[model samples]
Target chain A: MGDARRALALVRKDLLTERRSKAAFNAMAFFAAMVLFIFSFALGPDAPGMAAGSGQTLLQYLWPGLLWVAIFFTGILALSRSFQVEMESGGMEALRLYPGDKKAIYAGKLAANLIILGAMELILIPVSAILYNIDLIDKLPALLGVVALGSLGFAAVGTFYAALTANLRARDVMLPVLLFPVLVPVIVAAVKATTLVVRGDLMGELWTWIRILGLIDLVLLTVCTLTFEFAIEE
Target chain B: MNHRAQAAGSDTGRRVVVEAREVSKRYARNWALKAVDLRVEGGELVSLLGPNGSGKSTLLRVLTGVTRPTYGSVELFGAPPKTSNGKRQHLGVLPPQSYLYGELTALENLNFAAVMYGLKSHDDELVEALAHVGLEQAADRQVRTFSSGMRKRLALARATLHDPELVLLDEPYGALDVEGIGWVDAFVGELREAGKTLVIATHEIGRALALCDRAVSLRGGRVVYDGPTSSYEGAVSGATDSVRMEAKR
Candidate 1:
């Protein structure tokens, strides 16, 4: 089979698996929502407390970090799960033996993570806005664009490291440690662009942040594509 | 594709499907396989038999290109096994684990394997394959709900979906019931009729010797015996020290 077709088949299979079992999807979605709820609760659920205690409402300054924090933890949960299913009964080895470019395997996995994590953000983004009383609907398109770009970078690096640690004993703990340091640039870019879009400042330095996110996406995708075959081989 | 390229010599007109010479596979601490030489001809059904930790699965992995040997070499068809996508185009392997997606329905699992095996549309073939394994009624059922025997049957259907020429079966009967064993026997019988090559790794020495043309036994990563299957009884029973002792004679 051609590379594209093979990759599509794998994507279809993985998505179908998630659709049927809802294992990763349910867990990540609940986890994302819980993180948001906890954030709202910890910050006292209103602007008055922040204003009285710190001279500024918590959501006004912390929403961007909180949003990305929710996405980051949720993405880590989903990323760690990407290869865990395949580790069930040697499913990873079977994929490794599939005909054609091994990069297709990585592509399918990265795409699936992007789609799943992106969908999670779709819910979390709006909910995050309401909880923080931030009106983000006006910048929805730009915000989504930044989210997609950032997810691309995060998922690419996350997918690669997820595969790397799939067989290890402490992968749950190791994935975040291995992934977060490498993802500092994407996180910073995403947080910066998100803050800019939330503040309705797309014209000035927002494009630069988006460009940086895109560059991180491109670089991680390229590196992951080139190195996946070697990383997965026995 | 170079997959169909002809090797120089033939095994008396039979195609040499697998060739391994001085193949030694080592891990950090110990050898998994050591100085083992093996050859399998086209249309031959061979049994690789040994006790636990005797490298049966390791050898199967090396042959199917799942694991690379630390030293020596292996060739599948006319080329190295490393060319898995090409050389293993017609290769089917059932590793010790079923290697299936438990979350997927039986039909979906077969469809995934079929696509990977390069069959463009396997809907009809998958139905027929599932029926062959007596899993037609369970086609829409998720594999996690199925019994071990049913899973094995599903694995069998997936492995043979593309009609592979050479099949490597690792513990094909591990979780099988009597009926499951019978189903495997019938499948093997059919493969024999079609003249497909098969390498089976099993601890069921009697059954394997009865079905296979030749028996190759291993102990401690070394070949203990390589001969016609008929002599398996004597070779296994006569030796007092080690199975390797009788094969040396």
Candidate 2:
């Protein structure tokens, strides 16, 4: 229970700081919007758009993959910035100095990253849907569920790796380098589920993908929490 | 919950609060702390005096378990420093950094720290803590906008907000103004009056020697002199000068 209070305090502190500064959010917003714009321009450069055999354009057919791709890429900023706050403010040593489970720190950081990534997706999804001419209104509920699951899996690992590489001199480059590899299974599960949700679950396999994503999240969350002390150790 | 009346510890008749035996820490090839041994008893105010690379901060870090010793052991309240949070709940630390978020308001910072320390939500208590540090007017101001002295005062409040049995302060007077230094002096005087054990690491030899009873001076990661402050000045100089003369020989 004491650990719970500590975790909640961290979440409040981190979110309040980000809300005031907008450092991570602004950068993520700009980069996410740019990714969507560049991909749209590339798909429709000379022709009307990348046309598939059916009435679908390449942007529509590949919307799920492109959206998750943007999310994963842009999500890196929020995840790394979470721990970067501690690094810049010298709070890492302070965090270690405090006598607690230290896992509380991991949980707090993971929660904050999840919230930041969620907020970004809230904006990115609509913008991408408008740019790509995909109707997400009908699929919003299932799509959101899948998005949440995928993001949980992604953030769980991303937060852990962020702490692991926090003290490195080349952290910005090293964050993605270390994060993306371990995230392969998570990314694959998420993209697959999002793809099923967007195009159609005509074969009734959306649940299978969702189950896989949930399982992956469970595994990642456990491993990350258990070994977190080592990741943040001096 | 009232530890003022509780026994310091059941072991070591005097209740050894902080103990380190043969602790050595190396960063890469350079040893920052070489085979250091120290024992701080309950209610004893000790000054850890040293030069730039003399390892005062390193020893404090080892005692707090911020970094582990490559060799040797450390105990706080008769248990390993890496023990449970229940044991650590009695400890407080103020390192050189403010350990504060610049974007957060002073009040918000204290509130966050209070919750992290597992204290109940008491708005008046936080404001009172701020007021105690002469920061009541700046409660809503962002910490980044604060002067170095203001930040130090706030950090001091944050460190002792939980009212721990042992406090470790590294360079606590580093960025304070004259008035701020006086504030710290008064604060430490009050802590001593209340029988709190404090280990302060600093280069302000004059002020520290005045406030503390014993001085433990370090040179080149070794304890050169550990004795009463009355004899520290002459004894430390004579010892180091002889070592310097031997090196010249």
Candidate 3:
């Protein structure tokens, strides 16, 4: 098989595995809901107080931060579980022996991660809307665009970091330790862009954030694809 | 391509499929393989026998283009052991560890490996490979649920799926049971019959003796012995005499 076909096979394998277990998706979605719930309880039912204290308008304010937080934390949870499934069944070594492009391996993994995190975002959006009492109906397309771009960036970085941490000693703590620091620029840009969209602000400001996200995605994807051969080898 | 050029370029030459010229691997502290020169010709079943920390796996990695030698260079199919799009196509490696994805089923693992090798006839080949390893029944079962022996079989299936020209088995039979050993032996015999080159690293000297035509021994990152498996005892005795001489020095 060629690169594209090999990559698709890997993607199918990952998705089928997840479809069988459902553990990864469930854990991420559950964590996203819990985070939203925690924010709701912490802020209480006082809409005016939340609106006043958070600065900008309520709908414009909470949406970006909430979406980012959900994506970030959910991304961490999902990515950590990414190779854990492979390790559990002793399948990683088999994958390394295969003659496919290492980039295809990363792509397949990133695709799976994107799907899981995307599903988490789907759940988190409406939950955040209900919890923060913000009307997100008009901003659906923008929210989705943010989700796509943001998740792409997150998945790119997250997949590489997850592979790095897979065989490390303190993987649980080390994953976030390594991942969060590198992801600061990505999260900042995504959250900022998301805020602009939420507020119905000028597209001009949002384009800058989008560009930053796109750059982040491209750089991380290239670096990860090239370096995965080193990561997977013994 | 003509038959001779194809045979030379192909993984089926009677001459060496792999050649390492003054290959050395070093970290910050010590050298793992020190200026090692070796070759395993096509259709040669060579066993790498060594104790722990003896650089058996490192040498195999260099041969498979997984790890680059620090000092010198090695070649697979007359090309340098660097990651190339085509070099990997002709090589199959079964790492000492089970490098499969446990979340996937045996069939999925085989399918993934087959596709990566650009095996167009993957579906039929996967089925045949699984059956060859006695894994046809467990093909669809998640690898996480597999026993060590089962995982090894799945790995073997993956390695042989594409019918690579050169097969590198690093402790391939480490996890196999009694019957599993027979299965692996049979598989190796089949590969030899097909005229594919084999480089196996194993602690079990008897198994190596049964499968490999020659055995290469390494000690403290150096080649101490290189000869036929039938003369393994003579080789070990010579290795002991050399070590004794080194002690006297």
Candidate 4:
């Protein structure tokens, strides 16, 4: 119970800190939007499928890619910025000295990253819906489930890599190097699961992918939680 | 001739909170601590003094259960240091580096640490700890903006916030200014007055001499002198003078 409270306090600290600065969220959201805009222009207004295809089918195909791309790139942006606030402010070591369970620290960071990525996804979802002409109202719950599962996998790996690279001399370059390799399986599973849902396939393929994602999240989270103490220790 | 022997001979009569028997640690090709032994009782402030690379930090790490000794054993609060939750719970550690988050404000850092120690209603405690370390006004400020003195004070606040029975500080006063050092001295004095045992590893001979009840001087990972702080200093000075005279030859 005390551990839970401490974890919540750590989460609250990250939220409050981000609320004050707005730098992390802004950078992530802008980067995500830029990616979407580039994709939109590259696939131009008069491109192969834009004129002849049924808007629903077009959206169903494009929505999954758009959502996952936004999330993946934006996640990288946000996770890279995970310890920036702490490092810039010179407070990373101070947090470690606290007598709380190191797990709480990991959870707190995961929570903050989830919140930032979730917010970015929320914005990207609507923008992608309109731009790609996808009708998502009927499949809201399923889409949400996919997003939640995928985000968990991202946050689980992201938090660990952030701590691992926090002290390295080339943290900016090191984070993606370490994170992308480990996250490849997660991204593949998430993309496949999201595509099935976005197409409204209803072929029951979603559950298998969801289960795989769930297992991946669970394994990564457990490993990261146990190993985080060593990564953060001085 | 060894402090370990004297401590063992003395342990039968009194309560020993921490006891290290023939503890040694080796990292790869280098031996960080070679057959070191120490015993610290409750309510005693033992200053561990040594030159750089004398294994002071390594010894503290072993004692705190953070590092396993390659040879020998350590018991804390009458139980093997690793097995006893009560022993581990009673210990407070302040490492040489600031173990804190600079992104969070001073109050947030203290609050987070206090909660981890399972303290209920730490608002007043946090405020009091900050005030004790002269960081009350800057409590809402991020630690990154703090000067070295303020950062050290914040570190001290975090270490003592839990009110643990045993406090292990590694160079706790290294970065403090004169005034900041006085503040730390007073804080340690207060903790001592309240019967909390402290083991501080530092090179500041004067501060250790003035603040500690007992001092142990380490040379090549061995305790060469362990006794009352006053006698320990004279012995160190005499040894230094001898080495200097020998150099003339």
Fnat for candidate 2 (0 to 1):
0.74
Best by TM-score: 2
lDDT of 4 by residue, B1-249 (tens): 344343334543556888898888888877788778788887888999989988899998888776779999998888775566444557788888776776678898888777666777457778888988888999889877988888888888877777789999999888778887887888888888999999999989888988998888776676667778767755666655543454355
TM-score of chain A of 3: 0.91
Q: Write the per-residue lDDT of candidate 2 for residues A1-234, one digit (tens) a residue.
A: 989888988998999999999999999999998888888888872343344555677778778888988899999999889989999888998888777798999999999999999999999999889878889999999999999999999999999999999999999999999999999988898898898888888899999989999999999999999999999989
What's the residue-level lDDT of B240 in candidate 3? 57
For model 1, residues B162-182, the per-residue Cα lDDT tens digits are 788998899998989898888
Report the C-alpha displacement of residue A123, candidate 2, in angstroms.
Answer: 0.6
Better of 1 and 2 by lDDT: 2
> What's the TM-score of each model vs. the native?
0.93, 0.95, 0.86, 0.84
Worst 10-residue lDDT window for candidate 2 chain A reads: A45-54
All models, RMSD in angstroms: 4.6, 4.6, 5.4, 4.0
Error of 2 at B36 (Å): 0.5
- Evaluated against the true structure, the overall lDDT of model 1 is 0.83
Candidate with better lDDT, 2 vs 3: 2
Query: What TM-score does chain B alone reach in each candidate, compared with the true chain B?
Result: 0.91, 0.91, 0.88, 0.89
Q: Tell me the lDDT of candidate 4.
A: 0.79
Model 3: how far residue B170 lies from native, Å: 1.9
DockQ of each: 0.69, 0.72, 0.47, 0.33
